[model samples]
Target: MSDNWVVQNLQDILNRWNSTLSDIWTLITMSPENFQGGAIWRIVLNIHGALQAIGYSLLVLFFLVGVVKTCGTFVEMKRPEQVFRIFIRFAIAKGVITYGMELMLALLSIVQGVISTIMNSAGFGTPQDTVLPQEIIDAVEDCGFVESIPLWAITMIGGLLVTVLCFIMIFSVYGRFFRLYMYTAIAPIPLSSFAGSPTQSVGISFLKSYAAVCLEGAIIVLACVIFSVFASSPPTVNPDAAAATMVWNYIAELAFNMLILVGTVKMADRVVKEMMGL
Candidate 1:
């Protein structure tokens, strides 16, 4: 039964492709000029414009945050706990920003899906329109696939966003990991003004805790990456397959970021232990 479903789905896709080809052929053979301006093109252009805007926005935001954190680090040298607190604040802020960006992406995906469905329904008249053994072809053609955005445009935009987001998310994870390490590395350094204060040992203990937290983050990222790689390869033919793949990839990336946090904690612990000879 499952095999039959797969076969049916494949046929549907083939039919859609055939219809698309036929449309192109007709356009080329008929006027050739008719392909220049169309609603499909406009839809595609709009999507591209929106994505470019989003990307730029994220890049600027990341940079601004970096500048602020750097300034805080330099200015807060007299108060060690203040520096650590700022680090924690930055981590939380970045996480929130990332989550919000993801939510926006999700909304965009839904919009794209709806647009595609509408286009598919309207019947743009492509070549593959006729090849799908009639029954399947009719079912697909009648189902509203034509009302959606052109396949080429959709594929291009979706691919671009996925590529960009994946890289940015991975970098974000790495950044967090590095920050965690920094905090841990400096853990044993006393925040107190007095050189011979008894409270100096507190710094060592803090370092150990910080390292442990980083180690936990490292483990999480490793697990996420490993599982995601296995789940999505050898691509399936489902309509939702691309989205699913992106979802899993994002998950893995998030995990990777967590792992970095863990690594920071572990490093801090090791550094403190060595200092204390424990």
Candidate 2:
């Protein structure tokens, strides 16, 4: 709201940058079950419920296949010890199918705990706001008509880039939530693979991948915490420089920092997978 349009333009872009960071912070802490006031989660739960039958049917097939492959002869399978072992495997598989979603949620909750711990240890309640330096603003205010032209162009370009980066960052965070929902909705089909000894690797890999997905929140939170520390110290403005140079330096550096944070968040899944050896 500055009388100086250049100042106003810069302020608007900075505001958007701060708002997007705040939104990303909020999302990393929220659970899938609580997302969108639970509307999306309701649909996900219904789909998961419908898939339970399919998962249960697949579970029996895997268990029988496992028994056939693991036993060399029909007589070997008839032994009391073999029957008990097979019965145990079937019970475990059924239990896994029955509670697979809950298991995934529990894993997610653990990751949430990790995210909370990282934020607490880092002493950041939220990402710090990156603001336009006052020196730049005062300098911009002092620019005469001729000088203000370039200042206007600089602000316009910087503002557009900032605005674009803000949306890109927030959209990346939203995409993380969508991925979580997709993994949850189709969890049972992969989870049923646990019924077979030979095929259990499929279930193990599925669970590990889900854990990695949940761990993405932790990695993203850490990235935000690191960025918050960086934002606490804004880009230094040279008071002696031209108003345009100062603004350009500030905007370029500020935009670069924002890009760093956004890039880390966008690559959070890959980072977690690498760390977890997924």
Candidate 3:
């Protein structure tokens, strides 16, 4: 078979793989929505309402605990400053419980804004193309069918690996949205801890953890942007190598780079947590 025919066949496989990655990218870069037309998001918002209702009942209990802990005796409670502080704490905590969903959404919005800014600055308006090098194409074309059998096998394996990695990366991003929904749903419970001075640490820790989850997207985006930069410069093919050797070498490095991107996305939460000391 002619080299042109061989190159075109392999090129078609590469094109399909690239197209799949591009489709997955649509899911990755977009922000999640709670008030959207989606049933899942709406259900999640309803769950948040239910949790917030329960949090309201707990709010009174938490405030009472704070009052008892802070006030030594009835005489202490008579002090103007003591009375003012407890009242202010109760009021603020009540407000938080009442507006827990809004607060969580606001937090998500802020983090998404950060992601947008990073994407804009990085100039990543679309998914990065993961194209194989022309050298690899040329090398594959020079091989006879008998020799090209292994090349086809290598390409098939590489294509499958790339597609799997694309799904894995996109799913990691989707997982972040689910985490956001969960955090929003249960926000009131943790936030109500703020009503008690002794338990305020619980609420503070919850806020920190939630922020870490939200910032995870930023880390994932950064990883993808870095990968794009690396991928822009294809691996240098050895001109003297056999066709199978060149194809193997190229696929191996490409898979490794893809693995790095997938791993980064998977570890995004941990990365953000460590960065934020959460």
Candidate 4:
């Protein structure tokens, strides 16, 4: 089922790309007089903007996965050695997933940008423009190119799935290690008596810190996705207008991600200190 969904999604993306390319070709061929004006520059600018969007999307994904792994390590410290091994394995798996997702997101962003640019160049109103047929506008909005409820929902679901998968994989790997930790002399102390042993306290603190970091990271990613969706909306334009709007939108997204990273780190530090009774 999952494989089928993946295949279907890929097909949908390809179809959208083909449709977009066709529109661009039609526009250029229909009126060669307009092709050399702002239309050409708009196309170029939109493509560049789309690439930038993809770049930032991947960066966000990479940071998110890192945050997840760091938190997993801290959280599993109750069975230190066992958890450590699990963390290592999970990290490897996560790296692969993150890289692939990043690549796909980038490609999708570029396709979206190209399609949107073609539409605008052909005198289509911005996706949100009330002048456009409501149904057509809505369709474009829901297509994951613009920030619509469906797109946001998909992103939320995807994040949750990834987080749940990570949790499961980590637990599975640590299950065996946990048995060994239990047999060893330095098993993690119970949470009830966590304050008595410095080592145990350190573990507890680390776990708390990790949880806080994960929470912050999750929030940041959510915010970025939301902001990106809104930012990616096509601006109302005639062929003569500059295409720099897309570039600005990309810059705004990068700024948002950076803010999230800084905030997550700060929150983690505070949570760790509090957990350790410091």
Candidate 5:
């Protein structure tokens, strides 16, 4: 906090941005069981349990359908080898529906390993915080009362934009977490489709979508890591210029970097889907 309104305004914006960035990093790395103390996850588990009963009923129906469709004749079904193959399919499908939550969590664990590898290789223990340049502060402090007017206007607009971007970035991360919960809660219905060969595509697609959701975190982490490295070297400013011009230049450059990072986080799901060919 500074006595000068211009410095204080910019400081507030940077503080908000740094806080938001830190939250984003923490959210992407946390498991559903650890997120928000797992309260939401407990509700999700209860929902999954309730759905599992319905999944079992549907599982029986699908198993019957598979038996009827795959066995054109009673003689075919009576054959020992045919019976064994059909039995195996039914058993495997039942196992999938029963353990789908675990399966999904396992998938998530694998993707988290990828994120960890990325962070370790890049050697970023934490995100870099953006700082106001000393030159800009000195220049603003030295300004006459009349000359400070333009700088005041510049800081106001820049600070507002920075604040807006911070929320957008954080909301994107929150949206990802909600999707994870949604997928876990509704998993049983689609998982029941695995019992029938003709309907197995539904289960396959569901798994792929869940995987894409899990992998989205990796994309977000990579974007933030790159942005952190870029932030290490602050935006270049002209010390010889007027205080207003220098502040405007710094704010514009910093905002652009933030925009790119936020944009990447928002598009993380799309990126994962494209990679998955979904």
Candidate 6:
């Protein structure tokens, strides 16, 4: 044959994997748009606005509750430190109310900057391509029709596995996007608790959890980069083995590496939580 059929099959698998990985990268680094024409983002923005409207009312209630909890007598409210602390709390809470969207966006920006820095430092402008070895090509081309039958079966199965892993990896990144939208939409309610000294802990925890979610992107990107390095150095294939055995070995190792990447991407949230002690 003019072209090794195994090599041609591997190329198609490589293309699909590359396309999915590119989508993952795009999801990680690009800034999300809230005001864009897309209905999903706009709906998220509208929900955020609605929650913020409700947040103002909740802020007043939280502040009053804080006053009651902190002050046994009106005299305590008159003390310089107590009065100043309450004032500071209200001011911070008000700031959050007015700037919640900007604050959420800022957190996303910082995490994305970290992702960009990591990718740049690694000298990876794009996800690394996992190519089949030249020896595999040579070996497969030497196989007779009967031997190539099993080789073709192995290749087909490997291609399916790779395609599935690629989609799994991409979908994991999409889940992150959904979380981002969720956080933005509901930020005001948790943030409003800052108006009350007693309830400030709720706001603090919310911010920490949100920040942790944002940082998951960074962790996920790092995982992909590490996996790319592993992909670049695939397990050595023994050319002396029967063609089908050699193909199966290569496919098995490739799938294993892709599985590792997919697993890491799925665990991105847990990894971030452990790193941040959240």
lDDT of each: 0.38, 0.87, 0.78, 0.36, 0.89, 0.85
Ranking according to lDDT, highest score first = 5, 2, 6, 3, 1, 4
Q: Name the 10 consecutive residues with the lowest summed lDDT in model 3.
A: 28-37
Give candidate 3's error at residue 244 in angstroms.
0.5
Of 5 and 6, the candidate ranking higher by lDDT = 5
**Model 2 ranges with Cα > 4 A deviation:** none
TM values, all candidates: 0.27, 0.96, 0.90, 0.22, 0.96, 0.93
Off by over 4 Å in 3: 1-25, 34-37
Better of 4 and 5 by lDDT: 5
- The candidate that wins on lDDT is 5
lDDT score, candidate 1, position 49: 43
In the order shown, the candidates' Cα RMSDs to the true structure are: 21.9, 1.3, 2.6, 24.4, 1.3, 2.0
Q: Could you give me the TM-score of model 4 versus the true structure?
A: 0.22
Task: Kindly list the per-residue Cα lDDT of model 5 for residues 66-120, writing each as its tens digit.
Answer: 8888888899988999989988888888899789999999999999999999999
Candidate 2 positional error at 95, Å: 0.7
The sequence of per-residue lDDT tens digits that candidate 4 reaches over residues 1-278 is 12223223323432432343233233322221243464643554444444444444443444445445445565555767755654564454334333433433343344345444544554533221112222322333334433333433443444344344334323422332232222121211122122222223443553344333223322323322343344345433333322233223322343343345334433533543565455
Candidate 3 lDDT over 93-160, as tens digits, reads 98988987788778878877887888799898865776667777777766777997887777778767
Model 5 RMSD vs true structure? 1.3
> Can you tell me which runs of candidate 1 are displaced by over 4 Å?
1-149, 191-201, 229-278
Model 5 ranges off by over 4 Å: none
Off by over 4 Å in 6: 1-4, 34-39
Q: What TM-score number comes out for model 5?
A: 0.96
